[model samples]
Target: MFQKILIANRGEIALRVLRACKELGIQTVVVHSTADADAMHVRLADESVCIGPPPSRDSYLNIHQIVAACEITGADAVHPGYGFLSENAKFADILAAHNITFIGPSGDHIRIMGDKIEAKRTAKRLGIPVVPGSDGAVTDEKEAKRIAGEIGYPVIIKASAGGGGRGMKVALTEEDLEIALQTARSEAGAAFGDDAVYIEKYLQKPRHIEVQVFGDGFGRGVHFGERDCSLQRRHQKVWEEANSPALNAEERSRIGGICARAIADLGYSGAGTIEFLYENGEFYFIEMNTRLQVEHPVTEAITGIDLVHEQIRVASGGGLSVKQEDIKFNGHAIECRINAEDPRTFTPSPGTITHFHTPGGLGIRVDSGVYSGYKIPPYYDSLIGKLIVHGRNRVECMMRLRRALDEFVVDGIKTTLPLFRDLVGNADIANGDYDIHWLEKYLAKEE
Candidate 1:
């Protein structure tokens, strides 16, 4: 086990990793930007270092400063919680070269799975079902048109290296294809420094379901279960639940087993998620996240597994402790992402939090990084906290989530709490009758 671990990120995920390290008797060194010097993670860590200014390019994303902090704190391992450099293959390689363990998958796997096109190919080769799309990146408008025609109308153009809905466009007709191809290429180049784009048939109203898999990098792995992240806005997940309400027993078993086998065959290590789009009782691979996902808590709530602890253990050369047969899924869990934004307009809200109170009760958990008097900077993502609840079933879970939302309070700044409060009582949300575009359309109606 590592004596000390450096957390190379900020916000709740940083604190999440810190708490995990403490439980395992491992000291933590948190690196923060000047904007986050008073952040909760920094205050709670065993040691804290200022990396750079508020800008992410100079701060949270600065590799040299983070590496230097690790060297100064004598941290033998680094846990990049979720964002920033978590999925960066070069970052993992750099840590390995320094003889510091990265609590994640190998660089090779990251590189292969990070690209959207490559990930689809890999999934198809592993016998995992994938969406019908171009064989590779479509470089020109002519090729894009050819691929889109072959896939039929209503196709989506996506950046080969994109995420979070960036560098993506949908074309419903031939005329739309030219504009979509050009715009997607430009956005992809601007966002990821690669204009490469791929085409796929866009399935209408598909549910976003993802399977959580863990491996030991030796052709051994296990699947915990699946999370229903179909509740999304602008490609960002707003709400997530474990053991999707849509899948039956047979569908769950077959898909879960397929994910486990694929991961084991690929010799993947640590924690990763294989995402799929489900429509009409068919699952098509969308992409793979090679790092811990933002919605991982729902999975943990049902499985009772400390994914971070397992990540550290496997990265330290330990094999998986649980097998596919030994794993058991229980109950249902739901997570609501609380962000610093206007409930009506969804505009960013960055200011001092005058009064903050979190809900507490049986099976309710709040993972946050803010406190009363904490100033939320506008330099990063709007997400400030996540409220999670578990219950014997989905109905009970929704009831608890409603109660929890009513109890949550934050003053002196806007929050999305109001939005959730309204959502929890909606008949559609209560019945779990929603797809990926459901939230967007609901919000549109409200507007």
Candidate 2:
């Protein structure tokens, strides 16, 4: 086991990793920007280092400063808690060269799965079903048109290296294809420094489902089941639930087994998620997240597995602690991303939190990084916390979630709490009759 681990991120995830390290008798070193001087993670860590100013490029994303901090603190391993450089292949390679372990997959695996085009091809080779699209990236508008026509109308153009719905466009007709292709290419180039784009036949009302898989470097892996992240806005997940109400035992087992076998075949280590779009009882591979996901708590709640502990153990050459058949899934869990944003307008809300009180009870958990007086800085993501709850079933879980939401209190800033409150009372949300486009349409109806 590593004596000390450096956390290369901030907010709730940083604190999450710190707690895991403490439980395993591992010291934690937290690196933070100037804006996060009063951050909760820094306060709890065994050691803290100020890397740079508020800007992410100069601070959280600065590789040299983070590596230097690791060297100074004698941290033998780095746990990048999502975002920033968590999925960067170059960052992983640099840590390897320095003889420091990155608590995730190898640089090669990250590189292969980071690119959407290559990832789809790899999934296809592994016999994982993917959405019908061009065989590879389409360089010109003519090729894009040809591919779109072949795939049929209502196709979507996506960036080869895109995420968060930034570099995507949909064309409902041939006349819209030219503009969609040009816009997607331009956005992709600007965001990822790659002008490459791919085409896919867009499926209407598809549910966003993802399977969580863990692997030991020695070719052992297990699946913890699936999470339904269909409730999204602008491609960002707003709410997530484990053991999706959409799938039965047979479907869940089959998909979970496929994911685990795929991970083991790839010789992947640590934690990763394989995302798929479900429409009409069919699952189509969308993409793979090469690092821990923000919605991982729901999975943990149902499985009772300390994913961070497993990650560290895998990096330290310890094989998987649990086998495939030994794993058991219990109950239903839900996670609501508590963000500092206007519920109605979805605008960022950054200010001092005057009053704060988290809800607590049986099966209710709040993973937060803010306090009563912590000022939410505009320089980062709006997410301030996650409210998770578990119960015997979906109905019980929804009731607990509603009760917990009513108890959660935050003042001096706008939050999406109102939206959740409304959602809990809605017939569609309560009945699990929602999809990727449901939230947007719901919000539109509200307007």
Candidate 3:
């Protein structure tokens, strides 16, 4: 185990890693921007360092600053708690060359999986089912149109190197494809510094499902099951649940095995997620997240596993602690990303939080890095906390989430609480018939 570790990110996830470190008898160091000087994670960590100014580029995304903090603190490992530089392969590469262990997949794995086109090809070669589409990146509108014709209409053009729903355009006709090509290429280039874009058959109402995988460097790996992130807005996941209501025994085993095999083929190590789009009982590999996901808590709630501890152990060159037979999921768990934003319009509402009261009780957990009097600066992501709940079943889980959301009180700054209140209580979501587009259409009708 690492004698000490530096967390290279902020917010609830940074705090999450801190707690795990404490439990493992490891010292914790936090790196925050000037704006987060008073953030809860900074206050709670045994040591804290300011990386840069309020802007993320100079702060959270500044690899040198983060590495410098680690060097100064005499830390042996770094835990990138999602977003920002978590999936940035170059950052991981620098950490490797500096001899500071990055507590995630190797930079090579991240680099390959970071490119959507390369990832798809890897998945295809590994025999993991991928959505039928173009052979590679489309360099021209004519090529895209040609591929779309063969793959049928309603194809989607996606950035070949990034996610979070950016640089995505849906074309249902040849004319639409021609118009979308240039714009998508431009957006893709701007977002990821790569002008490459690829076409894939877009499922009209697919459910987003992902299998969580953990591998120790010794070639041993096991899965922690699936997260149903079907409840999304604008392609970003808002809430996630474990042991998806959509998956069955046969399907789960098939997907899990295929995903494990895919990562194993790459000699993947540490924690990662294989995300897929499921529609009409078919699973198509979408992409792989080469780090711990934000919503991993819900999986922990259901399975009673500490993923961060596992990551650290793996990074320390320990084999997987749990076998395949030891894995089990019970009841249901849901996590709502409590962000400082207007529910209706989804705009950043950064301000001082006058009051903060988190829900606590059986089956409820709150992971956050803000508190009363904390200022939510407009310098980063709007997410302030994660409100997760577990129950004996889906119905109980839904009801518990409602009560938890009600009990969660953040007096200042607009939060997605209102949107969640209106969402989980809705008949369609509660009944589990909602697909990936459910939240979008639900919000649209509210107007």
Q: Which candidate is the best by lDDT?
A: 2
Model 1, range 1-447, lDDT digits (tens) per residue? Answer: 899999999999999999999999999999999999999999999999999999999988998898999999999999999989999999999999998999999999999999898899999999899999998999888888888888898999999999989999999999999899999999999999999999999999899999999989999979999999999989999999999989998999999999999999999999999999999999999999988988889999998998988999999887888888888888999999999999888899999999999999999999999999999999999999999999999999998999999999999899999999999999999888999999999999999
| Model 2 whole-model lDDT (C-alpha atoms) | 0.94
Model 3 misses residue 398 by how many Å? 0.9
User: lDDT of all predictions, in order shown?
Assistant: 0.93, 0.94, 0.89
Off by over 4 Å in 2: none
lDDT of 3 by residue, 385-406 (tens): 9999999999999999999988
Give candidate 1 regions above 4 Å deviation.
none
Determine the C-alpha RMSD for candidate 2 after optimal superposition of all C-alphas.
Answer: 0.8
Clash pairs (backbone) in predicted model 3: none
How many pairs in model 2 have backbone atoms within 3 A of each other, for residues 3 or more apart or on separate chains, i.e. clashes? 0
Error of 1 at 172 (Å): 0.8
Worst lDDT run of 10 residues, candidate 2, spans: 140-149
Deviation in angstroms for 188 in model 2? 1.0
Error in Å for residue 204 of model 3: 0.9
Give the range of the ten consecutive residues with the poorest summed lDDT in model 3.
258-267
Q: Which of 2 and 3 is the better model by TM-score?
A: 2
